[model samples]
Target: MSEPRPAYYAAHEGLVAEARPKPELWRLLVGLGLVAVVVTVLNLVLFSVVVGFGSNAVAEGFLTGSTPLAMIILLSSFGFVTLGVRMAVRRLQNRSMGSVLGSFRRSARQFWVVFRALLILGLVIAVLPPYDMGAPLTPNLGLSTWLMLLPLSLLAVLIQTSAEEVLFRGYIQQSLAARFQSPIIWMGLPSLLFALGHYAPAAAGDNAGLIALWSCMFGLLAADLTARSGTLGPAIALHFFNNLIALLLISLPDNLSGLALFILPYDMSDTDMVRGWLYVDFAVMIVGWLTARLALRR
Candidate 1:
């Protein structure tokens, strides 16, 4: 007999049936478009709200600095993505939006469980041979600032990264998996889309291709973890902690560097530097997936 399907597979049967009852392809496309519009409108509203608060530094602070207000505004747009997905799911599936999270309590439990494991994993990575974290970005923001931003930043990054998971892993992956019996269609298609979206030809230059490859590999790992654990929690845990280290702990000093704790030494637009970083990123992605597997093992 074939192996049993995961619980999420059974739960989402309505969405993936041949009848396409929960969300047909046309509906999916429309939902995404609707999300795009909502995100834009919400961001504009947030920008207005921020500027009206008697602080007129949206341009400089939001684009490049350590302004706490900018940090919140810049990264909070992902909340809208979460909202958009919820709207789409509720309208199309007529199911409680919680289904996307798989098992809520279980997923939340798994998230912290995996997060602890990954933090130790991060330390292991940092201490590994031949990997230099390079210099910290200039002008440390002090203890109080970091303490203040810690909770807020976690909230921001969680919203940002979780929104992505909801879209790619929860919405897109589940939808396809519901429609197809094969893992290739359900898994690979979403990974391909995720990888393509990560490509920034202008910033990545020649390494954009490699970056896409790494992202695709990451998506594969995340998708696998989601299936393995029977919930989006492990995947979200893996993604959130990974990003917590990257975006908050260390980051490229570019337009998006406002909230980063450490700025990388190398320039993001440099082809050679980015290419070298890609190698390390690929290694990390593979290692991360393997680590998640270890954490989920019975």
Candidate 2:
């Protein structure tokens, strides 16, 4: 007799059940191609319009600058990815976007639960001693100004994080799981692609590989959460808080520092210090994952 499927997969089955009937490799490839075409064309049109109205330098700022408006624009563009995924899933798989998420009500409830748990954990971490870097953080936005922009900034981050979860954990993972029995195939493949997306040699220099590895680990944990919960909620909540801290709270001095209240003193190329911090972040990530898992029990 064949070994039994894992308990977590019980919930995941619902997420992937619709995909199984149409789990053709050609369909998956075509869906990916459609996503690529959609995002590329949309971005091109969006940026072209920006350049037409604004100077080239101004348009570039939306991509690379550290200002709040720039950050918002950059983060919000991920919405196009979500749109692409929805189109691909609906047209290719003959499934509603809601089906990709397993259950809408469960997802919404789980998201808030995990988010609240993480928020409390974040507050606790903030108070911990010996956790801070020695150098003072550079303030990017004034307190009053940051507070004023908080609502919109939060929305932008939710858009970016949820879009990613929808693509990786929602579309890709579900599609793969539908076609394969092994978690290694479904979970590992999406995590690999997600990691590759985070690879940035130009920005991180020597730390690029390490950063990519961290991203891979993050992807796996997020995938596990998605599988266990049978919804993108837990994964999205995990990603949301992580990005909220990184993008809106404190970020690296260079790259994606826009919308942050404070920027780190050291750049990504500061190998020794950055690597040390990455280790701490890795620990924190595991803890966050465990916390989310526990939260789901309640």
Each candidate structure's TM-score, on Cα atoms with residue i matched to residue i, is: 0.87, 0.97
Segments of candidate 1 deviating more than 4 angstroms: 1-23, 51-57, 63-66, 134-140
Pairs in clash, predicted candidate 1: 16-178
TM-score of 1: 0.87
lDDT of 1 by residue, 1-298 (tens): 4344556545344334432555467667777787788888987887777667646566567645446667666777788988988887777655455777776887888787787888898898778776564444554356567777888888988888898888888878877665566777777899999999999888777888888988898898888887777678888888898788777777776656656666777777777776776788878878877887888774
Candidate 2 per-residue C-alpha lDDT over 1-298 given as tens digits, one digit per residue, 9 for 90 to 100: 4245588668888899999999987888899999999999999998888788888777878778567777888888999999999999999999999998768899999999999999999999899987667688889889899999999999999999999999999899989888778888888999999999999889888888998999999999999999899899999999999999998888887778878899999988788889999999999999999999999999
Error of 1 at 37 (Å): 2.2
> Model 2 scores what on Cα lDDT?
0.90
